[model samples]
Target: MRSAKLESMIPAIDVRNLKKSYLPINRRAGGKTIALKGIDLTIKSGEFYGLLGPNGAGKTTTIGIITGLVRLDEGSVSVMGKDIISDYRFTRSKIGVSPQELTVDWFFTIERLLYFQAGYYGIRKEEVSDRIEQLLKKFGLYKKRNSKIRELSGGMKRRFQIVKALVHDPEILILDEPTAGIDVELRHMLWDYLRQLHKEGKTILLTTHYIDEAELLCERVGIINEGTIVVEGKPSELIQSLGKGSIEVYLSDCDPEKEALISGFSYVLEPYDGGSRLVFSVDEPEKSLSEIIKALSSNGCHIHEVKITKSSLEDVFISLTGRAIND
Candidate 1:
């Protein structure tokens, strides 16, 4: 293992001008499909980063290229300062990837499966036995250690997949939709565990469709759209740049003259609930609320209720991509 000081100085993963395309199965259909369009990305050691995109946005392709599962048509990639292609073995040894799909031996017991995973990295059964046991207990799967993969529940399988990735104790973890299709409680449990791993200084690269998940867990996020990264920054900073809080005012009644008076203000307004509810987008809701209320009162407009909504990472995503992350 590299020293902490040394690891802190080098990036966990780096890609430069990455481009990839897939050939059509039949030439009669159309041209080749472009998956990635010359994207650059870097994740620092011990940092938790998120890659968020819609389906077919090249997120999985990027992860595949970095983990040596898929061949890249163009560009260079490095893992921990070593060239990924030339130093494939060294790079592969440094990463533990829990892919989105469940690809495990259904016939094998949970313990046996993890033992084989560790053995693939040249770790003996005796050497990783304690580690395996510890992981099973940590994930609440210790009682089912003897159960076969096919017998475990969906949530159990997800936990086991993460355990398999950690068996060899790699320096970096790559999770692709780790919480997809799981129950809310299990997802929260996984989040807490991932937080613990980050606290332990493990570099993590997460690809998720859940926008709020990225906003809550990731230190920085890159939003990919149409096979390219459209934006990258801290969640809070991106929200501030591209989104504005909205103030929704509910009125008892709205007349043409009152509507005209409300529309006169320098704010974006939209009508809801048959023009009785007005939504105004503003930079600062707290500072603008008093003025808006006073203006409405002086104009004989009766305010029923008011709601202030802050900008969120999801709002920023929609503003940049013009579509929801899951869409």
Candidate 2:
């Protein structure tokens, strides 16, 4: 293992020209399916980064490759400045992954399962018992410590999965849809817990279907599409660059000349409510609003009401991918 002081100077995870593909199970189905197409990504230590993409966009494949669950056809991956392949045990020890699927043993009790997981990382029960108790209490799972895995609720199981991942106290935490299929309260709880973990200097790589979650939690985000990363930046920066804000103006009367003049602006104008309203997609609505109002007033067009909408992370995702995040 590298020294903590030395590891802090390098990136938590780095990938270069990553490429992966899966062979067809049946000959008649088709040729090999490409999962990742030469993607490059880097995550800094103690940063909360989000990896977002639609289904079949290679998000899962990328996570799998980094965690060593799926092999990459071509690429180089390093964790804490060490090659993942050459330093498999060291790199794996540095990361704690909570996958979307439930892969725990059904028969084991919650506490027992955690003990077994700790042992896998060469941790003795005596050395990890305090950490296990702390995690269980922090995640609200201490009450059910004696419950079997099969007896836990969905939310409880999700919490246990996170606890299991943290049993070894890895530096990097990779969470794949950590809040999916859970209630709103539980989801918010997990979000808070993740934030706490981030504060504690955990390098978190999150993949979530919820764009709002990514926007709220991630300091920076990368959106993948069709095996490639289309965009990567701060969520606000991405929204400002790739997303469009809108201004909807309701008019007192419809006039062809005024509408034609408004359409000449750089914004894309779409008529709403049979010309009674105009929806303009503008790059900067706040800067353009007064100009638009003045233009309308000078043209003798009466304004009834106005509504402005700022761009969001979801809008950026749609603009880049041409589809919703869930699609």
Candidate 3:
């Protein structure tokens, strides 16, 4: 039997039958584009969840709707059991969004921006200064607090965006491309802070082009494509489900006509190294390698080198989407 307290802990986010579409400005026939096709997803409380997809895959539109930026055509969204529309105030209060695009008030100083953001949540006047100072120092923006938003460097501005989002101390953090365009050092710094926040029981929803980021930080992921979620699972599990491993073979005299024959034995086959190298997935690497070599040798191709590539989150993503996230 489950305890009442535990059962009452509803998912941090619950989206049911979510749908949205856009029509042309002139309202021409056949000019409608569907952004979300009844997306159904859930993120448990205190969970680090990743929403992944290629460009124009409806990732941005979904985020906008969840953050109340885009109105939904149908369906309901809830945050911690509160309806997003009916209880807009309560649900909105729990979420802090860091949008993909860099948005900042060029007029306000970093300090003032944080202060103003905190004020939106009605933070007590006495505690606003403390909250702002704490976030600035945490994000390494204390010294740059007096700098205008336009005066700060790109990295500083990114960090300040995170700081502003955190100023209100929301329970759910929604980050879209949080580490995009930042240097590796700043990215590492942000990753460390995000990890700390997750450990402290904050629910995080991250959308990024970096596969490794999702693999490292997200406990679970949901991949969306063509305006619908195609797969959802732990990163490792998704990869393992595809196959045990992959084999890369370089042939001295490769036959393009034999490519389909090799693909017949595996789920994926791709040409590399100007068509001289062949990479394919396999359930049993040793057995598959032997068979591949035998087949290639019969085609008058000399094996130059062979290597096994371990399955990874990136592979799983590519397998599902048939392309990379940025592509």
Candidate 4:
């Protein structure tokens, strides 16, 4: 069950009672905008951990606090056992962060920018060139070495940022929505590269609104909302916690009054039939599916298809919050 195959390693990241707040000019008289509310989390050595949340869920705030971009109002953060505040330089040297925003100079080419970033990290002059070339090729940016920042596409720019962050060879990497807004093929390529990185013993913390991506790449994930940690565990575990049973029923046709009859059924907590498809949520999947099929048949409803699927993380989130619509 171990996703990371490293041997005899120590935890690369740790956080305790992490908290942050922001003050706004138009805030309530004495209340501060809570960004992180007492988060206690950890990432074992070489682990692929994901932080999943919707926009405004404080994913950025947590990364900002850990990387020293924002000041912390309470609690502590550490990377590779170095205190982020007290041993600031040492802590930062062991961590790399690829921000969600695209930040670059229009005039600089990919090669020059990467060299500059490595120089800023105090990497030896003799060692920088080889490392830069290797990273560029690995991320498929070698041909674009001389291309200006503005000339590259969105996916290329994201790959460039990742290369720059990794130039210093940090033990832990924090990626904020690395594949956001990119094409399907580019996303797959990026995913392949990240999987390689994870296999090479580099711990990663990923935050993305793309639920399916998180489900694929993350061995375990932490979900947060409204400045609070709602759930933390492996993706499968959280989904299983919701329930063992779920069913989706597709119908060939339906009547206007059929909606009311299906809605009044005791087994149905959630039901939807947009003329052709009728999805159902039930605690006892097998029993409910049978009853639903019988009722539909008795009422002259023709079911075109019926299938059963376990509750996924998306279902868990929606079930917990009772959300009508979501990402």
Stretches of candidate 1 above 4 Å error? 1-6, 27-30, 249-265, 268-280, 284-305
User: What is the alpha-carbon lDDT for the whole of candidate 2?
Assistant: 0.90
Give TM-scores for every candidate, taking all chains together and pairing residue i with residue i: 0.86, 0.86, 0.81, 0.79
Model 4 root-mean-square deviation: 6.0
Q: Write the per-residue lDDT of candidate 3 for residues 101-204, one digit (tens) a residue.
A: 88857687889777778788888667888878888888888998898988889988888888878888899999999999999998998899899999998999
Best by lDDT: 2
Q: For residues 85-105, could you state the per-residue lDDT of candidate 4 as single tens digits?
A: 999989898889899998969
Order the candidate numbers by lDDT, best to worst: 2, 1, 3, 4
Comparison by TM-score, 2 against 3, better one: 2
Report RMSD for candidate 1.
3.9
Q: Write the per-residue lDDT of candidate 2 for residues 1-327, one digit (tens) a residue.
A: 578766677999999999999989996898999999999999999999999999899999999999999998998999988888999999999999999997757687899999999999999999999999999999989999999978889989899999999999999999999988899999999999999999999999999999999999999999999999999999988988888898888876647354555754554445656556677778878988998888887777778889999999999999889999987
lDDT for position 261 in model 2: 55
**Backbone clash count for every predicted candidate, in the order shown:** 0, 0, 0, 0
What's model 4's TM-score?
Answer: 0.79
Question: Per-residue lDDT for 266 in model 2?
Answer: 57
lDDT of each: 0.89, 0.90, 0.84, 0.81
